[model samples]
Target chain A: MKSNEPSFYEEVRVNGISRSDFLKFCTTMAAFMGLEASGVGQIVKALESKPRLPVIWFHFQECTCCSESFIRASHPIVASIVLDKISLDYQETLMAASGVQAEEAYKTVMQKFPGEYIVMVEGSIPTENEAYCCIGGRSALQILEEAVANCKAVVAWGNCASAGCVQAARPNPTGAQPVHKVISGKPVINVQGCPPIADVMAGVVVHLLTFDRIPQLDELGRPKAFYSRRVHDTCYRRANFDAGLFVESFDDEGAKRGYCLYKMGCKGPVTYNSCGIIKWNDGISYPIQSGHPCIGCSEAGFWDNGPFYQHLPSIAGFGIETTADKIGLGLGIATAVGVAGHAIVTNVRKHKEITNTPETVAEPETKKV
Target chain B: MRSRTNPMREVHVWELPVRLYHWVNALCITGLCITGYIIGNPPALMNGTEAYFNYWFGTIRFIHFLSAFLFFFNFLFRIYWGFAGNEFAKWTNFIPLKRSQWKEIMDVIKVDILQVTHKKIDSIGHNSLASVIYFITFLIFLLQCLTGFGMYSAMSNSFLPKLFAWIVPLLGGDIHARQLHHILMWAFILFAIVHVYLVFYHDYIERRGITSSMIGGWKFIEEDVYERHETESKEKAEK
Candidate 1:
């Protein structure tokens, strides 16, 4: 934020933070990823070799907390690598330029660099009409669409752009949509959280730079390397899920003990994100880590699923004990015919192999003896 | 021990192809159940870092797909055999709509439930009850294929999705279709349990070669049983 002096991050990295602290941060990042301790070397190499990537950060219909969380990233290099080293060319919240100058800079970088720039959008786009959200007399949606046209890769900064966030919830009068809806051709990486973890955002950029292609993505277009599993899958609270120890009320003792929030309408089982595994704020905590339920903001249309505090009767794939009927008509289907069909096909195949000799036919003239 | 008291039945009751289909179907059904449970309820951590027992998922999937192709083609051949095979396995053998044959089913069910002893023997092609079960299992098998492909279509993103797109709306959409597919999996389990039990009950307990027929193609059909079926026919009532 201070344009003149060396920032707090630079001050610490150069003179204050010892080599152990620097190595500790690198090792901490690698460990948070469930990787071996030796992976810290890869991170150390990139930071030591590469000066900083140029970033064109855009803001639209959002609270701007993505930028805020990023600055406060638990690791000091997160901000140093992103904000200082990368030379953030233009950002509404953090840059020195303003008014016509900032808009002009944004356009110039996208045009001059063309396929070399990483476009970062931090909010949902209102499709109903640009009138609802206007920046410099242009709609937020219009700015995002134009900016991404020539960009190399796009990072949807938070749930607002990754999924439509609350702005695009059911009966969304503004007709809001996430960045993916308006984007095509170019690869878009959704770093989804209410405000994504700082290092996760940093890791994505580093990954793009370290390997010239974007990370693999899941069906939802969130990075598969990050969002490959449900928060429930890797949660320390999994024992409670199998044991059925659930939080009946927000203030109950169970919640304090950090019991599973599934029964209290936590969509962690169905919603895939890295919050449980890569706890936010330098792996210090996530929403579930802080004793609150995941609202499933990363998933599309999670807002329409129902009240966040009221659990659905049952998730469709949950065994017969939690069959769909128990949850009423919220969106679970346990159609007996569908699963039976899969099983029958599986059975038929197994039967054939057992009957058929998959054993290699002995050569007509050869003898092993 | 008692050689003369129990006379041996002569000849095989099942054709080779038929026996192969039977055994293939049995093995595939078992494999399907194992993999189906795995995909349905993914493995949990037993040890700290051990991955799930998921290697079978791929193997089981390949096996399941191949077996389905085999079973379906075998079904086509079985239908053809009904028209062209030996008299014991002919199309005319399973016409349960005939009247005294219907009476035979009522008496058979009563005899089965009560464990009643009957001195009269029946023709080997299939008794009325056996014919009905054969038809039911065939329909169940058909349904299993439909539901199986429907769920696989959810992931395969193949022609099935386009062909059965109508099923998605009928069942309430992709997720619901997947759910419906899961719930119906148990119906197959129940059907399989009953099928295996009845086969073993007849073969082991009743001393009938019902289980062996799919392998041997010939039951010990006494001449007296054939004579009884032919003479007892009441088709003239329709004339």
Candidate 2:
């Protein structure tokens, strides 16, 4: 079955891209993967000869943003070549077939490819009830288990699939679980972001196609190349952050001067992503560059961390979401009042005791120990 | 109640290392709390000066990280001193393991919290309740060091900070670790307030020269108190 599949080079040529363009794409992919120039030839050879890998893309409880991001990739070839070459047999958003035809195609791909295919899960799997998110007739959890049962590896495409995004935020209504939690014993490569950078998505696929294995992952199971450095480390506004020049509000003078948005609750320091470096829309701009503080959409439980406009979450134990300042100040004031009251009470009691007591006779001095 | 005017006998309690650790730890915690608060909620210092000239925030962070190191090492010194120093500073004294220690803890609580001052405190060093509280604070200090270094691991390339990098992920990521670290600062602040107040309170009531003992290492105890401590040590040695 695999022998009948056309290689990436053949597919690209048939799709109207020239040999030079394909080689250039390979080189670019190699660089994005953090491979040296010497690895470019290896990528070229692999793509030129290796059969296109079968992929079954699953969408669970999501907004279809990952699919939108993938389709709108800045590089035209990413859609025209990489997407074309992937033999994407099952993606609800992108696949043309629907109803029985789509279900048939999914079944055929699973049966024929078995362990040879890769599973690309784009959203979190809902476990609350089967009725919450269903495809064809099966729940997302049921569908994911069947699809990932024999896949070579699973690539969790975005924050939803990687860390459950907003759907799995605090008080998660759907009991949404990321792919890693649902699937076990398989390498789950997380390309995390609200809608992860398009090139990053393509790069992970390219690495899989070329290397025939999962990429190195960080502790959070994200690709190390893109997720290792914090967004703050590579942010253009880092100098401003270090210098303590911050935008006080959305329309402040500091905002106009391109100051750091940390005071306005930019979570770049804690969030790890390639946004500051690789950037979005082909390196045009990112959240910080566009005068918006990062919402920390990439990190786990980002939604519950705090408000996007505030620096820190008001700890929950207080009656409402209150900042440390309010709580600390209140405690300090209360303590001061208590101390004053206690001092007054002690003074009065001491005065009464002193007046009641008579002068005591001096005792003989004991020998020093 | 016998005479109330007996001359006090001075006994050296805190050693040189203990006194040094106390003041240095106090200074380091103060520095950490101030700079840590700024780091968490930075002020919008929008001075018209060039970004290069205004490195005040960077200086604040530098001082925070520096004091963190000092605090960590100072704590380690205290831990070592607990093992090697005199009986007053020994690990056994802080553990609150014995039945007598528990009694002392209750007695101290009665005097301090319940406002019942009938029972007398006989120990020359830290009372049982204070020692237990300090032990708990030491545990908190260790946690602070772990989470602080874990957050620093991302920014720093040093091997020491790198060792703590796992703490972030293990504690459910950087944001949670930071939150825990930030909240613990308040614990220290509350501890400091109560600790200082209680020290002065005990000094006034017992007249053992509590505050100055931290500086001079000598605590003035009544003759009976000194004899009791001496006899207790002699009994323990014989046992």
Candidate 3:
């Protein structure tokens, strides 16, 4: 720890936040991380003693939704204390420094806190061309490589950094790839979502700060605390899905009844996220709650999964006949027609042979007689 | 000079275990395909009933999963029977390791496909080409199991289905794995169609009672053909 740097507790105290509110913030973060009551104490102790963790947030081929979501953490303590207390050394979107000055600050942070700082990447990197995304005349790839070179751990902020979001969808013109693909040898915590829940982002930071290591991640590198279950599993309307009652269309009677959106092409069955448990925009409502089906923004390659309004995707290489059932029906009809033709040929051949056999037999019999 | 007429003789071809496995497998596949298709494209049955009043969709998924387990077990049993059953049902028939087996495939293709010849294939069991196709079908069955159970793991809390969880990520995600699984269901349906047609065709042309053989566990082969097969088996055993 640096001798002169103030700890997170001191920063909170200096910012006019009461000790009780700061403790409450810790408790909320612990609960969001799916931790037991004991976890709150650990977070408190870590925040009080440890020096503020240095973070460098980078932006590349992204929409800055992650930054927007982060500032709107809902809990006032999170936006005011936790985020402010974190010694955020360099953030392109949030920081006031720009041009040569911003580049200088980024470089200074890398040198001053080498191997001690955290790197939170907010978007994907374009490997197809360096010109696709650049800042300060440096390519995104170059800046990302430099930022992640000596970081303690890398946090891939949203779906863009986790799974290459829309920019990396089918026919990707930029050849954009996720953060994990570009960086290696460091623990990359993928916070998956088009724009991950603000609390989830705070919860991840809390987990890292409290445990001094990355949380348990699933096979796709998403935190297990939030990504362990599918959105459908925890949905409030799951009973409706099981009941076979579904909203047929946006303006239908079923839509007014708030039925399950499964038939409306909800990707909740496949998407893994905490949207159902922690609703968006301060737990007010999620996509399904507001009469919109989940687009599966958290999942990888969701853009290519198919149309948002259709449940089943058309099979990719099947030309005009896209759906699996359509192709199957076509194949079935072709086989039936082929079989009938074969059967007709077999019968014709048999009839000719039977007719010819009697003539040959009569000729042999006459010769013998 | 050969005999003027060759008498047909009954050969015990399909063992009891083989016959049971066949019927059970057929039933399981039918159940799985029907339930699986419904899961993929569920019909919208809108009723004013409360959510708790309807458990039909849940039951349909349960049936799909139940048939999947049965299908998986039936497939495993057939693989075991391939080793334990008669020479005609042996694993050797499915794998074209021998030059004679390859030649048999070419010969059958000539007769069945090219239609250049009307000569009959002399095997008393499944023809060589059909065995190869079955082998491929078995591979597809394995893929179906991995993907089906892989998706099931997300909904299930048991240890068995969780074992196949790795397949979901390996195939890209839940949706891709599901897409592959659904496409292969159609493969099974197509295989069934061709298989049934060939069985009927072979029964009519050869008068071998091929269709009834699966049920009765016997095939009627010409005496000379059966004798030749016996001699060939003995020679192979000796070698």
Candidate 4:
């Protein structure tokens, strides 16, 4: 696949994209990466000179939603140029080669590229048993470790590969783990979402190709350009949250009035993502804009955070979904009852003590020696 | 029947600063609990006016944060006073170092929990067992402050709350820190109920003005108990 390939700029030109259109793509990529206008020229120069980056995308215990999101990206250049430009050596879902031929291509890329290729992980790796999710007689964990041994960087594609999503939720039977937990020593960039926004995925790739470095990341290893602010911080309905106008239920008047969904269990306040700003489907609308609350899918252990419709999560340790109100009210009632019973006994005991004591004659007040 | 008199001596226990801290902290805890509850589970207020005019939730959060500051500063004052104030308020009194203090603690448990009314254990300051409980409560108070400030750090541009931003990540995340903060409020509420009940119960049994001591800083001790306290203080001073 890598034999005699032209550079990204040449490939785009061959695909009928004009030089001006390619420059516009570079500017959009720079802006998406939160870079200054000067970065656009640098991106153009990099794409014009450097060959396409060789990427080996791996699939594990996942639904392939990340690949679906990436292919369905709204930009024409994203689908036609960037995806095609990257010499994606081996992807089980997207590539035409399979069986011995696919394995041969993967080995060839690993040998030829060595430390230059990027390893993109699309889902969590199940370590409990190799049979849980195996590809070509090898476990996901084994393949992931082998794939990233000498790669330049690792990109965790979505929540599954970054935070172990639903497969690693409470009572996880497969013992699934995220990519970073499995591979160390390499720079692991997490594009975290249930399925991260398509444009965001494209932007990360563009930034990596142009700068020849991983984008600046937050404490969670997510690209800071996309995850720096929480959903609540930039929400259009934030004014309603501050004003205390909350939707009591899904079909109430507050819902019709476009009140905040906080009371209906919106996780926007705790979730960090670019959905509120970048939006989805070519900046059409996001989930919150469509009147549904954020489920905090980008966060760690979101599946175990509790029901999506409840406002506050139940106390975590209790086996059932027991709320703070139930516990507090129960304890308060018990204490009141105990106090009332104890008061009765104390009064009775005091009455008995008073009755048992005999009267004595009082002496004139005098100072003790 | 012959009549006799038992003379009692009055001793000052709590200082002005300590008493002031006690009441102000009580008020702050009450305010914090109420406002924190509202913040966590906000009610759906009827929308009659413009959204700008309806700042009830904002006001609730402001009150919670204000009470948090008062709670934090009052706790700091108490810690300082434990080092600089009277013997009863000193840090040494809280630590169960002496054999006598340990014995008094057991005796207090026997009388209070076991309901053995015949035992008469007397001390001018806080009982050893009560001091230990207060010490633990102080630690919980510090935890509440840390988690509270950690949650505020994200919203606040101020320097003080920002100092605790590390706590959120350390405790797993903001939601975990919030759970801890909320649970500790219940701990304080439970402590208050037991504390007030025991204070009144001891006042009835000991007749030492236990409840009133916090108000006027005076405790009525028997003559024998006063002599013993005087000799102990003199020995401490000599040492």
DockQ of each: 0.04, 0.45, 0.46, 0.36
Worst 10 residues of 3 chain A by lDDT: A360-369
Q: Candidate 2's residue-wise lDDT over A70-90, tens digit each?
A: 777766678864367543687
Largest lDDT belongs to which candidate? 3
lDDT of 3 by residue, A1-369 (tens): 585788778887888889998988898888888889998899999988887778888889999998888888867766754357533567887677788888787788789989988898999999989799998888999989988899899999999999999999988899999999988899999999989999999889878877899999999999999999999999999998888888878998778888889878899998889899988888898999999999999999998887887777777787632777788889989998988898887766544323334343222112211
Candidate with better DockQ, 1 vs 4:
4
Question: Candidate 2 clashing pairs?
Answer: A314-A322
RMSD of 2: 3.6
- Per-model TM-score (chain A alone): 0.76, 0.92, 0.92, 0.90
User: Which regions of candidate 2 are displaced past 4 Å?
Assistant: A317-320, A348-369, B1-4
Query: How do all the candidates rank in terms of DockQ, highest first?
Result: 3, 2, 4, 1
Please give the range of 10 consecutive residues that has the lowest summed lDDT in model 3 chain B. Answer: B1-10
Task: Kindly indicate the candidate among 1 and 2 with the higher TM-score.
Answer: 2
- Local accuracy of candidate 1 as per-residue lDDT tens digits, A1-369: 114444333444674576677777767666554456566777666555544455688887889988888888777766766555444577888887889898888887877677878888898988898788899998887777788888899999988888788898767889888898888998899898778777777668767655567877755567766766667678887766654456767887767766667667676755667787777766788877777777776666566554565444235355434653343212223433434453454344333222322221111111222
Candidate 3 residue lDDT tens string, B143-217 = 999999999999888988999999998887888887888889999898888889988877776667899999999
Q: List the residue pairs that clash in candidate 4.
A: none
Candidate 1 runs further than 4 Å off: A1-20, A32-39, A85-87, A247-259, A310-323, A326-369, B1-239
Compared to the true structure, candidate 2 yields what TM-score?
0.94
- lDDT order, best first, reads 3, 2, 4, 1
Candidate 4 lDDT by residue in tens digits, A246-279: 8888888888888889888898887888888888
